[model samples]
Target: MPDIIQLLPEYLANQIAAGEVVQRPASVVKELLENAVDAGATSVQLIVKEAGKQLVQVVDNGSGMSATDARMSLERHATSKIRSTEDLFRIRTLGFRGEALASIAAVAQVEIRTKQPGQDTGTLLLVEGSQVTSQTPTACPDGTSIAVKNLFFNVPARRNFLKSNAVEMRHILDEFQHLALANPHIAFSLYQNDLEVFNLPAAKLSQRIVALLGNTYKEQLAGCEEVTPFITVKGYIGKPESSKKSRGDQFFFVNNRFIRSAYLNHAVLSAYEGLLARDTHPFYVLFLELDPKAIDINVHPTKTEIKFEDEKTVYAVVRAAVRQALGLHSLTPSLDFEGDVNFAPIRPLRTSTGGNSFGSGGAALPAPARAVEFNPDALAASVAAAARGLSAAPKSARCPRGPPSRPAASWRPFIASWASPCARPKPKCRPSRQLPRCLSCLLHTRSRPKTRARSRWPPRPWQRPQPARHAGAGPLRAAGREVGPDAHRPGGRP
Candidate 1:
């Protein structure tokens, strides 16, 4: 039997730790930038080649380390952030575990060059596979510049698992953006394969946002601020119209460190329930400041998840603050219930003098005249006049010798003829034969057939005498008596 349970070597342990600390090229970028920030750097520059697969470098003008300190910094668990266990509870720096550099050095080839401000010389240390290859004196600036090359080179499996250059570069950009936003006072620049992607100058938060996101964000941003004993929330939230269909623009930072919290995000979304569409997400860069003791950042290796002492209270405060900001900027709809019920919209009025003026600036116009009430008799008279007009014949269409006029009593025969089911034979028209004025006018106005237009002025059927087909068939008939051919004759039987 053999004792298989043995301690793993230091190199193997560091490599395993690298698995958690350096998931991809973006992870390496995060660690290096945070270290530069923790070192009190006011300006940081990042350069990458082949999307960080070949090389990733960070240069910072911070307090450089001495030769001894530079050599010891590569060792595992070597850190200057905290001295005792109590210090962990009050941690403020971005990197605290001191394992980031060691883990990175295990899986990649790392080179560090640093020099103190008053030192005559500097130190350049190179390491590969957790083993220091060289440490020598060199002439360099009073700062630190670390270059990581051939990441995951020793671990072929990890290298093979990486994504394409574009995808990896996107992740790198995301990390860079987070750091830049968290520290707007610090100048930052990024270069990829000699092409400049970002060169942000030191500026205020709003200016930094517009610089990073573009000028279009200038009008979409709304300021949010709230302070309390437990926590303080402050940041900018996008207007509802600026919301996006994707979820990449939302960010939450606690103590200037980015974190991911679904509960807190829900609080913000609930505040924007009616403002945003169901599939859309609002853009926000919210930062929460609270006592370090009230939350734990060491729960995860990445430190992007924190446990709050009173999450509910924080949620309420965050939601209220965002809602208030929207309302203050008039992004939210509001109504005034106290307004007068009879209030009417002001409109321009045209005066009798042909001048246009607003209702409030000019003399009030006279009221519209009331309409005249209806009169049945007058309406009936107007209708009768119109009917008479329709019956009148034009002067050009009149007979050569005007139709003979007869007594008004002659109208009774024509009315009776019009009411009959069968049409009566038309009577002859002659200057000697007279017809009522009304009948003459109606017969003259009646439309003749198209074929008869050139025949004569008055139709022959109404002009010459018509032979009687039967007795009493002329123009008139007695009541209860059948109309006959001679009914309309001068001496016809009743």
Candidate 2:
């Protein structure tokens, strides 16, 4: 039997590597743009057709490549940025893996036109699916121009996985903004479907941000600069009031290379603890400058995520920088020098001048209150005089002592035998015709029914008087004894 394990073809190996490096059209655009910037290009232009599904091209005006170098650059693991393994620790430039160009050429049709400064002619090389089809010397301008066409043409499965045109365009725009922001001094322009989307000229970082994002960011930025022995944080942070609901405006760049770090982002958000609303993120374009050996940018395949040697220190520094910027610009939550109204000066209602108060014509203005002197002897004399002159209170009704439910066990025997004159029983009723029958049914009534039913005692003030069922019923005289004045329920006020 033949060996099951065998080496894959060069094209097959290149295609597999392409799956990691070239995720979508945005990945291709990122690689091409980075190469342009790394070439020391002062001016660069990007053109995309059909959201980079058909063609993605980058043109630059910097030092270009020669014919031989152009052909060699198509092979995997070919780069001039590093020499030895130690160089990986001090990587400062972007796109150093050397897999971008090779992987891109493996899945797309790539064309290159580049020329050095002293060269009389330029080199034009074309490759399709990792196979060189043509190599010739042509007349072209200085610097390099790489065009990638028919992306994922050889891999139908990968091509079918792409998103809509608008979504892909949005991704491509994101990569373009990152590269443009990373290099503020470099002039950059982007054209989608022959229509210009952004034409950012060489300018300062703030100006570049305003041009790239929107004009609304012009007055919202605040400068943030902090330098430490380990790291230096510098950039512009948006004012707290200018924060938005989405986090699309936040950016973190390490050594002029954009990256994503949630830990670092949290540090920034914490600085805006009470300033920003919940679920709202502030806009910031912070650049962290540190020794390359202290960070590892090669941790991720796309190099957009990095690992710091001491992340805590970096977080502290970033938080401090952002906080300083916010406080210095807004000067909010300041101390109110105006004293409290509750402690204002008070004036006496009656003035000391002739003891005059505000009256008809003698309306005298109130005088400033004066402090009272303490006199213990005078206070004692006044207390004695008031006690001697006090009058006694008039006697009223004496309330019954026992509980309404029943007398206490200690007083049961005494209360059982005790009897008051007012509570003496009346003689049994006799059917007398005069006095209309004493309304013991009516307590104190001259006219009442011959036989009245006993109503509830101590009538509730809220109940209405019932109409007479017979001919001679009237007033509270028809009801039982009047509930004298019970003042227990005032207005229920505290």
Candidate 3:
């Protein structure tokens, strides 16, 4: 057989890693922003064009890298965070994976200009397809400026897989939102085609949410805080009523690092069980702090999945803490409907004083019109039924006021007793047939064996059975007399 073994080039390996690390424009944004944070940047600016497929720039006034480190940063597995295998388990930084920059450089044209503080000159390096074309000393600021252009230039198939500009821009915004939430003390600026979308300064967590989403959520947030001997939880959860139609607003971070844990997410939703509608979800920005050894952060290339050692306990604690916070906020309050005693239900028409007025303003307006009467009984009973907490369904088509026939199966899903959709009055729910079958039917159909009621009828294996006492401790005796031989002799007299 011919020689079959061959070594893959460094550039090819980096390109393969790029497939996992840099999936799209947003992926690049996530990595560069993380690097900026790791550089100790308090303020970071992000700019993009054509949803970052054409241009992407990140500028941060962080602790910039030295000239040599700047050049070495493009190499795969080149990182300042990890040195030994033990260091991987005790990671305290976000960009330790080291594949982020290398993968990004592999797919796009990358340019880096960075200078550490007190350095006479800065380092400027340019690379395309993981091949360095230029490296020189240059005058620059005391931080890093990375610009990625023509993403996936060599790979046309990957470029074709990218989404539209608007869709991709939204993804970039979402990434920026999570990062901004995780670090409220850091200032962030986002610009698209020179039009500023977000220019947020250092502010409180609440301020960050309001600024990022909008002012509409200002009054609907509730704060949550809990500190235990093992872990600490602190952040905000949206009021049950303020939940959105989508799950786009929920966020969870562990030690300021964003994560996606369904197990932990269920803990959040479980807390809002009775308060929120079945279809609705509550919004939360929760932060969890624990010892590094208790969880594993290396489960995924994205560093979003973390394994916990006692997840059940953590789930319960987080749920309870969020529930307590909601309770104190009184986010879900009872409804109150009462007539305004001072005002009539209907009033007489009044004249306007503007250009379309009935008369000149110089003439005093006519005396206040008399109040019109309104009958409380004029409303339909169906309206009153809702007030009494009863579900007011369709009026059965007003079928001639006679005995009604069964409706079509189309309505069966809604009226089914087991369906939870009809259980609420405010939010309308459409029942789905795809719901899982219940175990109640199986349990009821199974036959059960009958057993004695005595508590000790079935003794444990380790315990001794009690002895039953008869007339004597020897063989069977009749009336406390041993008559075995005498009885046999009398019967055999012959």
Candidate 4:
């Protein structure tokens, strides 16, 4: 019992910690990309192979670390971002936990080639499963290039838990988009399986969004900005019509770091309550800037969830800011009774056909049709006259002969009788000399029966009727020879 509580090995501890930091290839991608950004990298390149199961490399033109710093960076609880407990509460940079590299190295084969700007040479270090295999001097660029290969190599269980290539790549793209969106001033490029997926240059936030998503966003974006002593919210919100059925387009960044907050999300959505459909979500990329001490980012290992000291105040400000932006841009609906209802239609611009003299000289083309002015009074008079003429016509003259008394109500029944040759009545035969006159009269006048009432428009068809029901038996029985259930048996009679 005395030796039962032994200390865990450094490698084992780091591997266990890796469970929190490196959940999947996308997690590794996130940690590495943030580290590159924290190093003050202005230009970064990300390359992945086999959806990061085979390779995930990040090259950054940032301030590279010294040889000793590079070696210690892989040690647990060692970091250059913060120095004391108070520094943790006032944190401004990303990746301050110092556990990212240590945890990553514990589960994957890690290689780092780094050199400072003034250094004539560089240091190349390789570690396998948290064990440093080699460290040597090499000639390389004045930056850092870290490649994490064979992720979860030693942990078969973790490796097997990874999703398919398409799914993993989507996660990787999500992480990439988050970083790229948070830092518009930094140029970022991504290559997957030797194929260039994104090549974004340093630009403004609006331009960066258009470049990352597509040029179609250029017209859909509406600027949002609000400033106060407590906080400042600034970003872009898409037009109402641009809302999507999917939730992928929404983003919330606090103090320049991507985060997830249902409370804050509800605030933004409340601002767009009636503007979007129930199933649709509006596109927003909003950033909240406030004092770091007012919020705690250490509440989670991923740091995507934070607690604000004044959550309600922040919520109110965000909601109001979004609403104001929508109103200021005229994105919200409005009514104007005095506005003109008839707008001048725009004519299509004519193009030159190069044959006519007017077309060759770029002269104006003649109108295709004359413009007609609408007169309400004249239109009403013409409609009334047509109505009067229809009302004055005799009812008998409106329909042809050989039809029922009421043409409209009796057409279906008469047509059904005419369709059956046996039930139809034969037409009377006359001499050939009177055939033309009779045909003319039948075509000119409508024939109506003198009788006022009819029993049924058309008689029902004749068929073998159903049999009468017996007193005790179930319903009617068919008219056929009766047979018992055992009639088909071997010794039974028909």
Per-residue CA lDDT of model 4 for 1-494, tens digit only, reads 35678789999999999999899999999999999999999999999999999999999999998999999999998999999989988899988989999999999999999999999999999999999999999998988999999999999999999999999999999999999999999999999999999999999999999998899899999999999999999999999999989999989999999999999989999999899977999999999999999999999999999999999999999999999999999999988889989989999877444433454457555455677999999886543333333222244432223233322333334333332121112233121232222322333334433544334535332222456667556433333212332222343221
Minimal lDDT window, size 10, model 1:
418-427
TM-scores of the models, in the given order?
0.70, 0.70, 0.67, 0.70
Error of 3 at 140 (Å): 1.0
Model 4 quality (TM-score):
0.70
lDDT of 1 by residue, 1-494 (tens): 98889998999999999999999999999999999998889999999999999999999998989999998888889999999999998988898998999999999999999998899999999999999999999999888999999999999999999999999999999999999999999999999999999999999989999998889899998999999989999999999999999999888999999999999999999999899977999999999999988899988998899999899999999999999999999999899788877878898755564344446566655557799999999876543443333223343433322333322343344434431211222343222133333333344444333443244545444444444444444443233232434333454322
TM-score of predicted model 2? 0.70
Please give the lDDT score for candidate 1: 0.83
Please give the distance, in angstroms, between residue 435's alpha carbon in candidate 4 and its true position after superposition.
32
lDDT values, one for every candidate: 0.83, 0.81, 0.79, 0.83
- Give the runs in model 2 whose Cα sits over 4 Å from its true position: 1-3, 337-494
Model 3 off-target regions past 4 Å? Answer: 332-494
Candidate 4 lDDT at 185 equals: 96
Q: Write the per-residue lDDT of candidate 3 for residues 1-494, one digit (tens) a residue.
A: 99998999999999899999999999999999999998899999999999999999999999999878998899888899989998987887888977888899999999999999998999999999999999999999889999999999999999999999999999999899989999999999999999999999999999999999889888888999999988899999998877767888889898899999899889998888878876888889899998888889988988889899789878988998898898788764544457455655687555445334345445334566599787677554323322222122333321122123443444444334432222222221212233222222221223334544334535443233334456455333333333332322222221
lDDT of 2 by residue, 183-253 (tens): 99999999999999999999999999999999999999899999999999999998888889999999999
